[model samples]
Target: MRHVLTALCLVLLTSAPPASAQDFPSIGSQYVDFGASMAAVGQMNNVMGAAVRNRRSDRVDSPRAAATTRYRPSPTVSARVRTQFADFIARADPAHSEGLRKFVQQNDLLGAWEQHVAGDGLRRGDVADAMTAYWVQNWQIANKVAFASRAQVQSVRAQVAGALAGSPGFARLGDAARQELAETFMLNFIAQGSAFSDAAARRDAGATRRLSDAAAARFRKDMNLDLRALRLTEAGLIG
Candidate 1:
C-alpha cells in the first residue's frame, strides 16, 4: 500500500513542477509530523511509567524527598524517539524536515527537551503538564498542515479515482458513500489514525480495541453496507 502511494507521488512529481513554497508542508508533512509526535508520546509514557514506579519504591530518604522527587527521563527512551523521528523523515518530503525540527524545538521535544521541559528531572506535575502541552501543540500543527494541503489531496484523490474507476471495491460503494470518499478520503485517513494515537497516549486500551474492531467489522451500521468488502478492496484483496 505504501509502495502504491509512493508510486503515485513519484508520478505526480514527474508530471509537474515542484509545488510552490505555499505548499511547503504538504500531505507528507502532516504524516511525518504526526508520526514524530506519536513517537514522542510513546516515549514520554515510558518515562512517566518509570517515574510512577520510582515514586512507589522505598528508595526515597524521607517524606520531603519523596514529595520533591522528579521524573528523570531515561536516556534510552530519548534516543528511541530520535531514531523513530529519523525514520519518519526518511519517508517525508525533504523540505518538511526543517519545519518539523522547528515544531519540535518549539515544543521542547527531542534535542530541545532539556531546554524547554527541564534540564533536570521534571516534577510529576510538570511532566503531566508537558505531555498535555505536547499533545495540544501537535494537534494544532497537524490540523494546520492537513488543511494547507487540501488542494494537493484533492488532486491526488482525483488521480486515484481515475486509476481505480473500474475496480470492484469502488464499484461497491453507494453514490453517497462514493461522493463522501472522494471528498474526504485522506482527511478521514488522518483523523482515524490520529484517534488510535490519542487512544494510546491516554492509555485507553478499551478505546483502542473498539477502534480496531470497527476497522475490521464486516458491516458498518452507519455506512449501512458491507464495509468488510470495501476494506478488502482497499487492501488489494479484491479488484
Candidate 2:
C-alpha cells in the first residue's frame, strides 16, 4: 500500500506540466541531455573535491599532506569539464550552470560523499532512491527515450564514460581505474533506468520496488571494492 501510494504520488507529480518546456527540448533524442548531464556531474565532483581540499589546507597546511590529495583534477581537465557543463546548460537551461556551480562549491558534497561511503550496505539504498527520484522527475523525457536500442545505450554509455574519465580526478588515474569506475556507474544507471521504465509501463508499484531493490543490491555488491579502490563515493556514483 505504501509503495502504491508512493508510485501514485510520483505519477501525479510527473504528469503535471513542466515549469518550462525549453529545459528538456529534444536533447533526449540522441541521449544528448544524459551525456551533458554526466559531464556536468563529473565537473561538479572535481569541484567538490577541490573545495574540500582547499578547506582542509586552510586548517592544516602541510606540503606533504596536500601532495597526497586524491581527487583534484588538473586545471586543464577542469577547463574541459567546464566546457562540457556549458554544453549541457546551453541545451537544457541557459541560466543554470553558474548558479549550480556556485551552489556545489558552497555545498557539503564532500561530507555527503563521506557519509554515503561509510554506510556499508545502506549505500545501495541511496542509489536506488536517487535513481527513482531522478526518473520520476524527468519522466516525460525519460519515458519517451526509455526503450533505447542496444547500440544507442552503448553509445551513450561510452560518451558518459569518456566524459567522466577526464574529470572527478579520474584523469590522474590509470586507464584500468578509469574503465572500472565508468563501468560501475553505467551498470547501475542503465539497470535503474530500465527497471523504472518497466515498472511504469506495467503500472506495477510492486515491480518498481522489487526491481529497484535488486538493482541497488547489485550495484552495491559489484562496485563496492572498485569505488573504495578509486576513492570515489556513492555521491559520485549516483552522479
Candidate 3:
C-alpha cells in the first residue's frame, strides 16, 4: 500500500505541469500564520522539563510511587477507546482513513490513549466518549474543507506549497523542488497523523520510536529522501 501511494505520487509529480507561483492560490495568509503558530506550540510541548520527566519516571518505574499516584485507565479500556475512535474516524472520513489505516493500527492507538488517561486521571470510558464527541464536531468542519470537494483540497494543498516555497529557506528551490517537498510534507502528514493517534492512545516510548523508525525507512525507500532532513514537526502537516 505504501509502495502504491508512492507510485501514485511519483506519477502525479512527473505528469503534472510545472506549477508557477501564480498557479498556487492564496486560501488566506492568516491560515498560514496560524499553521506556524501551531507548529511552535507543538515544539514547546515536545521539550519536557527535567522535573516533569523525573516525576513521570517515578510514576511509571517505581511500584511504590505508582501506588500513591492517581488511578489510570487500564490497557483493556484503552484498547476499547482506540477501537471506538478508529471506528468513528473511519466512518466520518472513510476516504482519508482508507489511506491512514495502513500506517496506524488499533494497538498503536491503545498505547497512546492509555498514557493520556494516566497522565490526566481520566477514565477510559469517559475519554472514549469525549473523543467520539470531539471528532464528530470536527468532522463537520473537515467535511466542509477537504472532504467536501476535490477542488478545495487541491486549493489548500497549493496554498500550503506556495507558503513553503515563499519561505526564506525554500525560496531558492525551483517549482519541481517545491512540488517534491510539498509531496513529502503530505506523506509525512499522513504518517504523523497515524503516529500521533497511536501515541495519544498509548504512550510507550519504545513503540513510538519503532513507528518513527518504520516511517523513516519507508520515506527513504520510497522517496529517496531522508525523513530527518525534512525537519517536519508533529503538527506541521495540520496546515
The numbered model that scores best in TM-score is 1
Q: TM-score of the candidate numbered 1?
A: 0.26
Relative to the unseen true structure, what is the C-alpha lDDT of residue 125 in candidate 2, on a scale of 0 to 100? 21
lDDT of 2: 0.31
> Model 3 — TM-score against the truth?
0.22
The weakest ten consecutive residues by lDDT in model 1 span 230-239
* Residue 168, candidate 1: alpha-carbon lDDT: 42
Candidate 3 lDDT tens digits, 5-79 = 132223222332333111111111111111122332122212211112223111222121111111243545334
Better of 1 and 3 by lDDT: 1
Model 2 regions more than 4 Å off: 1-91, 108-111, 121-239
Candidate 1 segments exceeding 4 Å error:
1-28, 32-70, 94-127, 138-239
Ranking by lDDT: 2, 1, 3
- Count steric clashes of candidate 3: 10
Query: For model 1, what is the C-alpha lDDT against the true structure?
Result: 0.31
State the lDDT at 98 in candidate 1.
61
Residue-level lDDT tens digits of model 2 in 1-239: 01222332233224323432222212222222233235433443344233323331113222221111123224444344334433543444446444434332333322332232232211222222222223222221222222322232223222233333334354465433333333223222322343344455557766655544443333234222111122112112222
Q: What is the C-alpha lDDT of each candidate?
A: 0.31, 0.31, 0.28
Candidate 1 lDDT, 60-137, residue by residue in tens: 222211121123444454444444444444345466556544432233222222222232122122233333223222
